[model samples]
Target: MEERKARTVCCIGDVHGYISKLQSLWSNLESCIPRLDFDSALIIFLGDYCDRGPDTRLVIDFLVSLPFRYPRQKHVFLSGNHDFAFAAFLGAIPQPQDGSEFREGWKEYEMSEEREGWYREEGYQGMHLQGRRWAGKITVRFNTIKGTEYQGSIYDAEPTFKSYGVPHGSSDLLRAVPEEHKKFLTDLVWVHEEDNVCIETSDGVKTGRLIAVHAGLQKGKKVEEQLSSLKAKDTRIPKVEALSGRKSVWDIPEELTEPPTIVVSGHHGKLHIDGLRLIIDEGGGLENNPVAAIILPGLKIVRDTDPLVKQ
Candidate 1:
């Protein structure tokens, strides 16, 4: 019989469209996977795949194509605020066009690559997914106008995807997402349905302890310990609240307002807060926001440049 190999799940946090940073992290991952001889693996790519960086579409394409290369593992996508916006843009919802413009505004990363046989002007690349594409591929030419901004062009008339959330607009993104990734966003972004704190032993059980979440749970408030007190889904950390029955991360006022649970989220680049939380957005990529992920190879929870690696 073939050897039964153990599996590992790497729960990654916000990537923010940093292609270079992702490359560097992947370089490191190459060694981590084999050295341990771990079985199968899953990369939970916490979302916000676009914006604030250079190669937005490149990142999206790369993530979408992951399963092709590694048929043995799964690449899960979690919806962050930005990704949700991009999804809305794709569906033609009337949100801000700045994000769409930003994409339409830039050139593709491969545009400059010598491999491409064409030499089109950087300004030539067209909009994708309804004006959503890459920032690096083109430049933002801002022109303010009284009638409709940007020399009355209907394109600039729209606003960038609002950083903030709107009901119908936000949901649109989730609605039209690719089939496989749809559940990841729904599972994370929407509210949960939990009455008491419940710790679900992932299929492997070991991955459960990793407690990989887009944002860490309240500090000192181990999901295992505070399972019962968790009232809503929004504030609860990813895993604990996932199994719990809550509506959305927005549902829990206690977690969001006052006693906000300590989180290990990637939003705050250099996590600045109180309580027993740790920030894993370790300033990844050069000139790019850091890319952070937790590698649970066996019983250890490992991270990039993280002193928290279990000994």
Candidate 2:
């Protein structure tokens, strides 16, 4: 048997679609960690690679090229809610197990479809709820404390569609996105687990298991059941709570009493560092914020705008 070496896990939060910010963040990560460790690091991107910003296409390109560029580093590309919707729009999402067509998931959300302004363009009649939702128009307005209007919908996926040279809600996006990029989107995992990882806490440094998902595990659901569904990539079930729910996924499930898994996520659009649960999405799909990451062992944070980079 091969002995496994301790890996430096670098968990990156949501990178909406800002390639420049991602590039700068990558540079900062490289600068902070030793070159050898960085080269062999286990990089976990906490999903949401598409939507909200410019250059979604470029962001996917960069993610797809990482394995080839850094052969030794292990990369985990998780499927964020946005990426899932993007994949659904391209007809790349996995099918439901009940032999139901992808369109079945759209029925429940149909009443809101008109209100949400779901994509009714070419081939949309056969798409999933997430696909339509991904391309839907904004039904409500968002404003910052300064009263500046946030320039997108709840999904904020228009930029993603436009980034691929297709208008929002257009089936032309099916061909607009490159094949490899589509594969990347389709291959994203719903959950990732790493055992024997070192975690930093007030108690002391200890080795524990870690789980990374886009949003989080549903509070009342069983961990194994949730893991089983996620592992199977079940799409038949309408409304994946892990991908979209907020308050429901906020608390860790009480049933996981065995080894106590440390859960981390990013879709909340906020940076929350709670005891064992860490939500690191600081960008919040905003134009002014920087992409962020939390390095393992010490849980040291490094952002795109880290002082090391003279930005």
Candidate 3:
């Protein structure tokens, strides 16, 4: 059998709409990795591309432009919870399976609709759960574990709206995001699988499987069941645990007994690395922190501030 060449897989954590920082990070990544490896790298952006920061529109534009500029590199875009809401606000979320109406799932979350400020604007009767949550208003102020203060709502999507020249709850938001960008948001994947990647162990280099979701997989749920729901792009469920649930997705599923798949994610807002589970969102969409990424095989970490750092 022909030997499989060693390749690099780059996983980027939550971007949160910082154009300059993202650009800087990209420059650093390009500078650090060899040209051939950089060109052929499998780059997976772990989601949360919009919100919090001041350049959501520009960030999306840059993301959408990746394929054209780096044609040889493979890119996988995952859907972050905030990005899901942004899509919902723009009516770009994936449709329910089987062509069923989205409203069928509304009753489950209806109680919090008022609190979350589900869309009261025109054409809201046809909205989906994410659409409602994305457009909903709330009085809650969120303070992160690191003491970052987020005022107004959970998703903190106001900056995204403003980046596109609209207010947080304006109906004009649907018209604000460009058609290509809306398509970009709608096309985001819920999960990605990479087979036969190499990982370095204490003893030796070994082949491994990798599954990347925006958030970690639920601890107790059947792995197939979770993957089924995610692959189906089911929106009827009130919350997609893979996208937003924190504690639920923190651990690897116990039933994944054989083959030893590596589960990686972002959206937890904290960096965690334990054996096969990697959470890489160091920036956590915070203004002061640097966005981060993890290089495969060697498990090297690169940040927006210290891009050349490697193992």
- Report lDDT per candidate: 0.39, 0.83, 0.83
List residue ranges in candidate 3 displaced over 4 A.
1-4, 141-152, 307-311
Candidate 3 lDDT score at position 190: 88
C-alpha TM-scores of all predictions: 0.44, 0.92, 0.93
- Residue 259 displacement in candidate 1 (angstroms): 20
Q: For all the candidates, what are their Cα RMSDs to the real structure?
A: 14.6, 3.0, 2.7
Clashes of 2: 0
Residue 19, model 3, lDDT: 95
Q: Write the per-residue lDDT of candidate 2 for residues 1-311, one digit (tens) a residue.
A: 11234468999999999999898999899999988999989999999998878999999899998999999999998998888888887888877878888777777777887657777777787778888777777666654442445334457777887898877666777888899998898899999998877777676666778889999998777788999998888998768888877999987787753556778899887888877788989997788987899988778889998879432
Compute the lDDT of residue 276 as modeled in candidate 3.
Answer: 79
